[model samples]
Target chain A: MDLVNALVVFANFVLIPATAYGAQLALGALGVTLIYGILRFSNFAHGDTMAFGTMVTILCTWGLQALGVSFGPLPTALLALPIGIAATAALVLGTDRIVYRFYRRQKAQPTILVIVSLGVMFVMNGIVRLIIGVNDQNFSDGERFVITAREFKAATGLAEGLAIKTTQAVTVVAAIVVVAALFWFLQRTRTGKSMRAFSDNEDLALLSGINPDRVVQITWILAAALAAIAGVLYGLDKSFKPFTYFQLLLPIFAAAIVGGLGSPLGAIAGGFIIAFSEVFVTYAWKKVLGYALPDAWAPDTLVQLLSTDYKFAVSFTILIVVLLFMPTGLFRGKS
Target chain B: MNMRNLMLFAGVAILFVLTGILQSWNLSLSILNMALLSAIMALGVNIQWGYAGLFNTGVMGFTALGGLAVVLVAAQPVPEAWRAGGPGVLLALLVGAGVLAAAIALHKRMPRGRMRTITLLVVLTGGFFLFRALFDPNAEAIEAVNPATSGYMGGLGLPSLWAWPVGGVLAAAAAWGIGKTALGLRSDYLAIATLGIAEIIISVLKNEDWLARGVKNVISLPRPWPVPYEVDLQQDPRFLQVAAEWGFDPVTGSSILVKLLYGGLFVAVLLALIWLSERALNAPWGRMMRAIRDNEVAASAMGKDVTGRHLQVFVIGSAVIGIAGAMMTSMDTQLIPGTYNPLRFTFLVWVMVIVGGSGNNWGAVLGGLLVGWLWLIVESLGPIVMSGVTASMADGPLKAHLVDSAQHMRLLTLGIVLLLVLRFSPRGLIPEK
Candidate 1:
């Protein structure tokens, strides 16, 4: 075994997992940033929103699976994704109309909106739990791998083997496609520019004859789509659990804040940054290092700085440290 | 303030009576005591939010510390277990402290940018392992004493009553630390920072099995009131006469007697704190705090240090929450760390404060009492609501299924109630002007 062989093995496992995770996080962060920009407060319900979306997707996937509707070498959830996104978007828009619109009319403070989001979070959580119970549901269905680890090792005749799963590749491709769509929607469209103009200066935009309600509506649709996409990706990668999705709220918020809240690109960059750092810092490098190092120099310990269980701590620590240094975040968020 | 106080007092009195009529007296009294504690907590929140307009979202952390205080000060000591591995544990603790100190010192001494980051990171990494090596072994020895019963070092063996005050102090110290770091930042920053710190505190409590026993839980904690042993007095002829006079069964009479005794003690503490806090809020310092909150820039321009005033109030308010925390642990007679989730203790408390008038102490107290009663009843009535709804439906498979699902309606109800309140009245029943 040599360094090059170890690198190949590392790429197959850790890098692939991290990249898939980073893309999912970036999607989640983009949703959060959109809400913070337009609504003007962190949406505590984002996690539950993801759960609600995933719950629909899972149900649809199950229905499709029972009907024998599935793509070969890909999850049946792929067919159910659009249905999930549409349903989720409708639910969110409805919630905005009933719960948030009243307070918006009262001209309530943003903090009040933040508190209202907590209430929404609880409701959404209950709804998801009510429908799916709290148990984790593994709905993944795809080819196990492009090449099994055993086959790869046998074929390469190397000590380190490689296996690339179909789901992982699909996750990365879907993320890139969705992100591209979102960027195109936001940058190349008239409504997208109007939304940005509104978030940047609402008073000026209103004076500029841009319809406030129209801009706000478009923002929610975009946010809901992003959230649904992110939720589906996360549920695909990990199993779908309502509480776990809620727990993801902290990290999602961390990514948004780290990237600079209100900046879509910043959210994406921040998500990847948080995901990669968390994976890297907590990972034990012993296996890869053992293959690379000289026989005498190989160490016994894991050689990790932090434990994997402290992933939340890593995100929070990075957030606090970054906030201490740069309050505006990486991309310098909107005024 | 007087009109608000009168209205609040009337509201609480009515709530107490309504709860007694609707539910049982025992449940009402239980909620009453908690309401009083919630009032204290709200007062703490009011000091920060009402006086200084500073939001401290880490109420759960300081409250948990108060629970820890009960364990530290009131729980009986396990002398044998302490003797076996207590010194080792002590040494491990010292090592842990040394690690933190070294991390801070390294941060200061190292040059800026990459050098500082690298130095701090290296020290932290090394320190983590060194302390873990020391702690894990000692913890194993201590836990080996009696893994099923009393496996670790116990408390100070003081009266349980002392735990309440000690909780306040611990909470205050925690508040001081958090405030020093976060109070100077913007409000939103403070919110996120506080949220992060609260999670960290909960994580520590959940994982530190040696201290809180993590999910294992500590139970049967002693209290400062009369013991149930007094129930045996009913066998006496004289006690029988008393029970007859009360026109109740011996068991009912004795339980109620004990509960009333606890109630009196709790009420006294609650009232004393309320009165003291009220006085403080009306004093010159209180007026200055209000002034600072209204216009921080103007306050600072006029030579009043708004930040410092905010810190002072933040610490005091958090300490009050700590007192409530100790009271809760004592009442439950258990320190179950896993139960301290954000939704229950933290967000619920936020709802109480916001719904209670944010700036008014009386409003807080009233809101606490009303909400606490509502919380208890909501849990009980949630199932009933579901049953009634489902019962009216046609007797089919769907009806049977919905009835079974009724068991999980409380969470939905709670969420709906919160949304309704936020929509109709964000300032609570009485707006704190």
Candidate 2:
């Protein structure tokens, strides 16, 4: 009956979820944008590569769990994540050298590279499935919540309780830290500038005496590391399943495209836009509406803009609209 | 193109003969038919990538749509279910069409810029609500009647094979729509768009349970061929006689017969498509497509309608894939939406296209059969290959380890095959002119 209490609950549930989701998409979009910049193709396998990286981390998490190691306040998966990043970095570098190198040398079309990545996608998918059967595996081994709903209600003395799960907090923090590091590395580091230079113009970069192989190697490593972090964080926030990663392709790609394909900052912005839109648009704001507006003004209907299931549809529609209006993405790629 | 062509045909025949010797004639024949369908699909890809040099990562979506065509055109209808879903869907479609038309008209008629965009958003959003409001009740009623099996509108009561051409038509139509807008963009744009379209198609198929039974799956679909529900092959003397001659059982003989029937149908379609593709390749149109593909700017300067030609090839190629999907659906006598995954239909088809040779129809056909057979045989073959390699593990748990490893070899083999092919012969087994 209390309007203020309802509004608070709404913010805690809807806004926080959207914010956390936005963080995940932003990180994932950064990974995708990085690869598209240097690799010159939209990798169809990026999602699964993320999955593969997470699977490695999950394995390590289980091993640590078996060894009775605990992060206490944090999920042990957090502890295992760096190791996963290293392993994923190795795998991505190997793929670049072994599979992608030949095509790069031949100067094959970007479309051809995309198809080749599809092949790599299938192989990676099969391997990931083989390693962890096609089922959702939870590896978060920390306390359930930063504040349980009961605890929140008792402290606030309000009808609405704000319960933040440990995993969500970790996901948000990790994403911010990783993204901050990525931007710093991309802008300030020698190798990072080299990647930007190459993405801007290959011939010019080569003329400037930048090593192409070195740039590519660095790009792959960075992309892999980003993918690993994104995958681990998303898996931690939700749950990790091979198929979920495959399905996550839509949202991740949506973020990348909306941000403009080659721009990292754009990718981050695009990801938040998409994630928030998907969350807010599908969110049943009836509860919040009841509180926000006076009794006469409160809507009788669910007032949800779209069903939750149509979340992907919204993302896709946004992408299509953006592509139609601005093919270079919302923020045009750096000239 | 003469002697070598004949030798290639003879080489294929010899391969078939080897299949005859090693596997059952029926099993070999059955695989041949599926392989033929795969080839047809690959040829569709070839026309786009090889001739027009356009990329389409949504082959699976088009194929599934083709399967939908077959179901719509052929399967027997349940009148109640039909009436329930049919009218509601028609209404939904009309409203959707109206919305799209209004959006487009607004785009044209209104002052260009934000005003037009706002008009579109308002109209589209209103239409979506209107469509959903009208759709929900009818869908609920129809689904309620037949909760499990016949949840949606039944198909037109006709021969399911009619679905093949219809599937082609449907796929081509979608291609035209997508290619017209997206094909003009860069390769990466096209890939992303196509991939999105594919996912949308899948989502529709999955959620629109009233249409293709959604994720629940439509099993025991009416087959163009016989279902063989008659006398168990064990009791059939004719099958026994054939089995004895072939060093097989009556059951095997029957399977072979059905497989051969399927194989013949698939090959006929494959040959026809291959012939059509080759003819197109040789035609002036094909040369222009190539010209446009190789250098868009040059071709455009030369007054070639590069985008138009690309749209044509993309549509035609997708139509072929759709037809092939219809054929596969017919072969299985089932339309399982869940079964037709992107990794298989979409990505695998791309592999077939790339490995075969992008522009070469023959290369695509060869690659399809090669990969198709490899995909099927690798499971059994992996163990044998591993057994020979792991003979040194006699003292350890190495044999079991090798066998376990073999289970995962199929994907590894697919990956290795693609990598090796791209590195060595990027053009494929049969390079086009």
In candidate 1, stretches whose alpha carbon ends up further than 4 angstroms from where it belongs are A1-13, A102-107, A144-148, A157-166, A281-309, B1-15, B18-23, B80-85, B98-118, B225-241, B392-401, B404-408
Can you write out model 1's per-residue Cα lDDT over A181-215, one digit (the tens) per residue? 88887789988888888889888988999987777
True-contact fraction in model 1 equals: 0.35
Instruction: State the lDDT of candidate 1 residue by residue for B125-229, as single tens digits.
Output: 788888778877788777777778877678888888889999999999988877776677666667677777777777777766667566677787887755444
Compute the lDDT of residue A237 as modeled in candidate 2.
85
Per-residue alpha-carbon lDDT of candidate 2 for residues B1-433, written as tens digits (9 for 90 to 100): 5566457646766776777678657656766776678888888888888887778888988988888887787777778876666788778879878989888888888898887778788998899888887777677667766777788777887877788999999899888878876777777777777777877777777787777778787776776744453246667777777779879666666776667767777877888887888787788987888889889999999999877888888899899989998888888877877777776787677778777777877778877887766665565467888887887677566566556667566765677677677778887766665
Task: Provide the lowest-lDDT 10-residue window in model 1 chain B.
Answer: B225-234
Chain B alone, TM-score, model 2? 0.90
**Ten-residue region with minimum lDDT total, candidate 1 chain A:** A302-311
Candidate 2 lDDT, A1-335, residue by residue in tens: 46777768776878778778888888888888888888788888899899999999999999999999999888999889899999999998888877899889888888778877877877788788767767899887789889888898999798778888888888788888888888898889988888899999999999999999999888888888888888998898899998889878888988988889889989889989998899888888887888778888888888787767678787888888887778788878531
